[model samples]
Target: MSPYTRPSIAPQVFVDADGQVIDYGHRWSDSPPTEAYSVTVHPERYAPLHAVAAALIDHLRLTYDVEVDEGAHVVADLLVAPSWDVPRAVRVRPRDPKCAALTFVFTAFPGVIVHAGLLHDFPYPLCGCDACDTTWQREADELEEHVFAVVSGNYSESVERRDGEPAAWYQVRFANGSSGGSSSISTVAPERLEAAAVTLPDLPSGWRPWPLRHAAEA
Candidate 1:
């Protein structure tokens, strides 16, 4: 939890000085958490985000047939692209991987990408300074905001992917008449992105896809 040390888990996921999403790994090394982590020092040791994720999953099970991996509920990056590593990508195996589920990105904004076609490009600076620490809290708030946005349907979001060059011009638009995106020059290029959309029957099961949805909503 020290600003100088890597938190095994923060309130939510965020990228590190390196461009990888912080997860329950060996902490100092690049290795993922071993099986012992789930029992002894699980990453959700940061209880706030864990509780939030758990609550959403509990809510979903009330109406749907939800199945989760034995220890699927862990603190990890919501896999978008290899380069779009802004953490807060929490996941619980509610469905088959990337078949018909959406992705939730709580980095630049609370974006619930309905499909992989919508690329999310954000800043992944190599700096690990106090200034970035301050920025971290502000950006990390997106997770809570995303939950609120999805549950209440009160979010204004836009997805923009980098284009043209590494950090140069980025072309932005939407399937409908969408707007709002980042124009910062300090961004890593987006690699491939692919995720599943939660398959929802058209019976209006009291729930449907929103422009931005949490992983639980899937």
Candidate 2:
């Protein structure tokens, strides 16, 4: 039997602007892939979150033929410390066209860390404030409430690797309208998340967690 229980912060149903958790994320897969993710935002920033997520998903598929899994919740940020050594939290934002999205930013990390300051736009003609600050506080609060709950239950799983290399990874398969073999996935990356950017060849339809293609194989 698997030696783990449900994550306390297990990606719960996405709470909308009205604080209602929607039953959209999560699905059944024949292969039972590993890893799951979601996109969330404060009750007020729902429209912005969805808008940016759509752009990001389209950018991924166009740049790479791979499909993103939509089973994970869509939140405003993935609240994590800027680094293991730092206590200050960082927010990861989705892409948006109406606002000047910060594709990436250099941080105080050892090297040039690409801060997914996706919502770090400033003087928004509409919001009249910096996007990053507004979303950061709300998203960070949400993440703080859930990260420990989820990580406490995060565990490794055995899966068939591309070859017989015995790689450690997980998948969040999609039984929904996804066009790929899997749903959302989280694995080691060749580059850091913020620093990694895929140039799109064509316009995209919506946003979903982009797959980690080069994750270590099992």
Candidate 3:
């Protein structure tokens, strides 16, 4: 069958900043394929980072040809007021009435796009309030520590390819937010990245399940 003839379906996978698979999504190949199954992702569900939402949307579109709605996934800047006290300072989501889940979610890294393993490492920190920070100090520390794993300059220098062409690379963004940029690590050639690890850091995280029909908005 052609690559795009039937929608790509596979086990959902999750990974850490080190690119280690944490949990693989359940799969049922024996089950018959059907279009009736549906899952909804409320924009108001889990507040996510702006950049993360962008990356997720981009990945969905480029990887699966999905479309995100404005109502369900709000694009404008979202403010998590200091006085109000929420985890994130800002959030973004689809503003659409509802977000439908796909029949299956890809949990592994996309062979095409550059996966930001930094989600587990250099993630944008979220703190609801000063009191919460003091109360949940331990939890915050544990979470922040995970992000640190992918921040070093060693991993950022690596590069990867897409569809037989050089596509994306990695780099460390400094705390100062003034220095650093992406670098090429694809010296091994495209075929290598498609089959095995290009960077020495660790294996890239696997993809997870997402809405199949709504994929066009991505």
How does candidate 3 fare on TM-score?
0.20
What value of lDDT does candidate 2 attain over all alpha carbons? Answer: 0.26
- What digit string (tens of lDDT, one per residue) describes model 2 on residues 65-142? 242333113221332223313212222322332111112111222111112222111111112122222342343333
- TM-score for every candidate vs. truth? 0.30, 0.19, 0.20
Clashing pairs in 1: 13-88, 78-89, 98-196, 100-197, 100-198, 101-196, 101-197, 101-198, 102-197
Candidate 1 lDDT score relative to the true structure? 0.31
| Candidate 1 structure quality by residue, lDDT tens digits, 1-218 | 11111223445565655768644323434433353332322222233433344444444344333343322222123223433324454332324322222233323221222111122333221222222222333333434343333333232222234565332222223334323444343432243211111222221222222232244654
Residue 148 of model 1, lDDT score: 34
Across 49-114, the per-residue lDDT of candidate 3 in tens digits comes to 233333334444444423434331221122111222222221212122122111111111100111
Error of 1 at 59 (Å): 2.9
What lDDT does the true structure give each of the candidates? 0.31, 0.26, 0.28
- What candidate 2 gets wrong by more than 4 Å, as runs, is 1-42, 72-218
